[model samples]
Target: MAKVIVLNKEDFEKLSEDVSPEYPFLKDNREIMSASPGGLFRCLMVRAEGEKENMLIAQRKDTLYLGYGRDYRSFDLQGVPVEHIALEEPKAYQEHAVFYHRPSHISDLNGQNPLRPVPERQTCFQVEQVVVLSDEQFRQFQENGLKDDQIFLFDYSDKMWFDPGSFCWHCVLVKGENSRDGILVDAEGYSYARYAAFAPDCDKLRLQDVPVHYEYPARAPEQKKTRKRKEPER
Candidate 1:
């Protein structure tokens, strides 16, 4: 069973520091760095099956990465080797949502804020669960067509790949009147929106013209449909 626990800034820091020895890779990881710069509260943490899987939601910085496969994907914290993970999911996570909160940079530049009562918009996606994908499992999905259910989230970080070049991971969900939203905890441990592409009457991915690529080898050819014998003979 997996447990989701919310930790305060202090507790989260202490826990992360304690665990750092066992998971040295986490020490300098961007997720942890961005989420808790100098021990600031940035995300939620998850542990599954007594250290079987440990995941966190790291915060993302502004100034998004544009273009196809801008960066590598996969968790170095996981057992998978960093190089292999990158090769498998070459594109960086790309489906990022732009937040419109009070500019922290501006606040820093100015000494004090006169707008005391003003509140910034909350830019958070309520996380429902974490989807852990391994290299072997991902390859299997490639051989077998990727089911809609298999995708927990869309290409927020674009790290989650379902297809190849046709849609690099950076594609965003199409805007629609009745689109449903889902939450995915990224490799960095941040929450991002995952729009349902298979929903009824929603050709979201197709509409976006997102390129599709498959890394695995293709299976046997599908049998073609043949027309029945002409009835004119009768």
Candidate 2:
């Protein structure tokens, strides 16, 4: 069993905006109503259960209704005690009401774990550039004495071969730098990496791109020799 953290409506509302900026779609959607703190709190409560399924809700006309999963557990929001009322399942409700699960690994609340307390200062990563490379190109990068440390971003999305569907982002700490780069890995093993260079000029190293790359590590001796030989005596 995991310990839960309860955030009140006020705190939840304040944090939701901060959270939105982290997501590209939400940041672009100006018309979308910002999620209420109560709603965000409820979502986090449900997420702590480690269940990635959509939560079920019973709406009472104009008033928004909240409920547990198919189990039909009832909950309250802003003094409104939600009651379970059955009606023809509306597709719009199904889509809009359903809150997607972000997975438990990244959602864990342990303070000791580096990845647990995400959305904190340490987890932040700036963006630099987005480099679209083929598998062979990536391999060549590896062969050319490029170390993973030199590259800020590494893909860990579900599309990749070894994703846990957590969508948790990680940072690569490079020496001689005050901060590290951020990397988001989805369940399918697909990855999006970001670096400090990606930070906007005006921002104090906050804003970041969906995916970016930084520097790679040093090359091996043989790799250095091969590069020297290929230099055409220049």
Candidate 3:
């Protein structure tokens, strides 16, 4: 349930008005220009309206790719769609149409008649599920870890552990001696091991592929103050 604020050519021009030199407005042939409401991320959905087919954009951290629909579907449909780019990477818009091209219900509603105080929308890279490796399969996974481009979850249920904020371990296998290990890579591609034997601070693995439910950590309630009677009004 997300809506986009479509920016026409004339509206797109305004992006350059106060942008820093580091991030510049797009001037290329991309036809659709739109972004998540707050504009922290910009998504370009289609080519200049003449391309034979729509291109798919997927982001692996800061890197963006211009891919085809079929190729992504072939990968068990696990392709991470680049629905938008952080405003910091203005160059991302120039490379490809990174956003999905469909208008949502709210967008249609807005088209019918504009609304004040538009609703907020969220965009991010998503994976439907992560496959947990079997013992034998995990051994094989470690053997050709980096070679396998599929995403996976490691079994860390023994520790009763989960990411402090996320449900899944959400990692990629790496070349290593231990079959139980998985490496966590940050947005910038820096890698680290999440295995308890290796990095204790690292988050424990998830036994299954599931959505991470995010809830604010509980805090102690503030004690209300009571005023004593003013000593019989002094």
Candidate 4:
């Protein structure tokens, strides 16, 4: 998942007018989208993409919607929850959500939408098995022969989603053939170290999503890494 930047509705509407002027990179799209999710009460989701320095923009937007118990751009039980934003694969777009009021009554842990899955303390990507590439297993790719980087070693892990204030919800640990310290890669091949990963590089790395698994090894405790609720880097 990409970094989502939630913004107040009024503030979101004024993104091109106010925020874009200072940050000329965002000036390209002088159109503030009507990305309101369902256009329900106050919860809205605008598109944020095609720009560099997304991290810096998110940080700046946070300051705009700081107080009021995060009502301005925080809770949206009916719409895209923070879990979806925090725990998905790394991508270019960012969510500029605007919540008029926090859905304090709605269960943040349990989702109300039937189509979408609710992330609980149990939802995660658990490593069921690890395969060590054998010599005979190395001759699969066509034309290019077997390359070391082609080998994939996913470390045992669990990316259970935590509270709404988390960005490190789920990530698969990848150990490449030439890797020294190993790599923590998201579904989009974004490493924990923030190295850009092309899709082709991680084409063979397929990690399964296990909402809840007890047959595997011990799972990582919920909220251990996400307790602080930090945002992911761009």
Candidate 5:
């Protein structure tokens, strides 16, 4: 396993917009990042060990990304070494829906032996629980404006091999960071749920020539946007 590399803002910009082949950890698998409970961040590599597979850690500013693999693809992560936090808990205790982390660093919550968390590599805390909301509450949350459940929030943590079908993503979009273009990433269970995927931007990554609309999650199916005619203009 290689140590995480953190770069200053000025230094990061000097690197290539695309994946670098020079570094040992910048893999370019096109698979999008996962948002499921256990894998809240695939490229994030933030969870406890044994939780991630074939991934490397890198940081720019305050954001952490999983960008590693023996082989390179279309994109990946690269950087220099820095002291960062890595979670060592074998497991998180779950009660009902919330998952509680018992890191040894926190004496008050000590019972099981867990590794102490490092500071700017960022703190390690487990947050997994279903957010609840009544129909009215959900409506209020949407009152601000029209929104799409299938939104692509990219931040350049591209991993081409991650499959979202095994998880909770019904749809995944691998949009390029430099181009502002998009690619729809799908799997067997891709229509799994009405969810979102936060993928990284690849410099020369492939893009979808045609627009794709994942229509499974119906958008206001019962409502008609057309207005009824006024009795043929009276």
Candidate 6:
């Protein structure tokens, strides 16, 4: 668990200098400051291993939201019925929505397992497309489509186990640039915070398709008592 520290512009700049080599995005970008007041910023502490990554996004407004996860889903920016975002796969004419959710299997509250499953909630965000001038082919996004801000989803049920001092954990979207190889950004500090950006023109993109399942634990049986023993005692 990492402690939350509010950094002034100078502190943020200094911290950026310290970690910018590995995460070059923090080097010369003025836009990083856009995450102010209640805007989103990545935590510079935790790292995720291989496919099992974790990331954190934080906001400082009237309220706060956070999310952390490894695997993520993809979504279409232009589509009908917002529920379409939850669709299992991307459709050919229809746009798609994609993002990550903590798979439900581990959260099952029943079964003989002593580990109490954490409760997860559906947190949604709208994805919009932006052009990455650096890369002729790659597409960029504006955080969560806000004028200058982005939104994220989080599950705080296990704050006690992972981050006892914090109230919740969150995943956030950050502006990224396109490189010759792929979309790139300096997210090493918050690698645990998995990121999912909207894919434009669903033709080439593949969204993670997960089967939905629900489970309910069986109720405990009531105890039964025998009456024959009472007569012998008398």
Best by TM-score: 2
Model 5 over residues 1-234: C-alpha lDDT tens digits? 233333433333333233342232232211323323344444422122222323444443334354544432323435522333322222222111111122111121122224422222211111111122233432332232112222221211221123335422222332221223222232222221122221222222222232322222322224657987678654
> Backbone clashes per model, in order?
23, 29, 0, 3, 11, 18
Please state the error at residue 205 of candidate 6 in Å: 15
- Higher-scoring candidate on lDDT, 3 or 6: 3
Displacement of the residue 182 alpha carbon in candidate 1, Å = 17
- Residues 1-234, candidate 1: write the lDDT tens digits: 111343344443455444332222222233333433555544323332223333454444531111111112232334322211111112222222222222222221122346632334222222222232334543342233232223334433444332334422322232222223211222221222222121122221122223322222322235999999878854
Report model 6's TM-score to 2 decimal places. 0.15
Models, CA RMSD each = 22.3, 22.5, 23.5, 19.8, 20.9, 25.8
Tens-place lDDT digits, model 3, residues 99-185: 112222222212232642233541222222223344454445333432333332223222222244643332322212223333222
Q: Taking the tens digit of each residue's C-alpha lDDT, what string does model 4 give over 207-226?
A: 33323222122233356453
What is the RMSD, in Å, between candidate 1 and the native fold over all Cα? 22.3
List per-prediction Cα lDDT, in the order shown. Answer: 0.30, 0.27, 0.29, 0.27, 0.28, 0.26
- Which one wins on lDDT? 1
Kindly indicate the candidate among 1 and 6 with the higher TM-score: 1
* Poorest lDDT segment (10 consecutive residues) of candidate 1: 82-91
Instruction: Give the clash count for model 1.
Output: 23
User: Which is better, 2 or 4, measured by TM-score?
Assistant: 2
lDDT score for residue 109 of model 4: 12
Off by over 4 Å in 1: 1-36, 49-53, 62-234
Worst 10 residues of 4 by lDDT: 94-103
lDDT of 5: 0.28
lDDT for each residue of candidate 2 in 57-125, tens digit (9 for 90 to 100): 222223333334432123333433322222211222100011112322212222334653434233322
Model 3 Cα shift for residue 89 (angstroms): 41
lDDT at position 140, candidate 5: 32
Measured with C-alpha atoms, the lDDT of residue 55 in candidate 1 is: 41
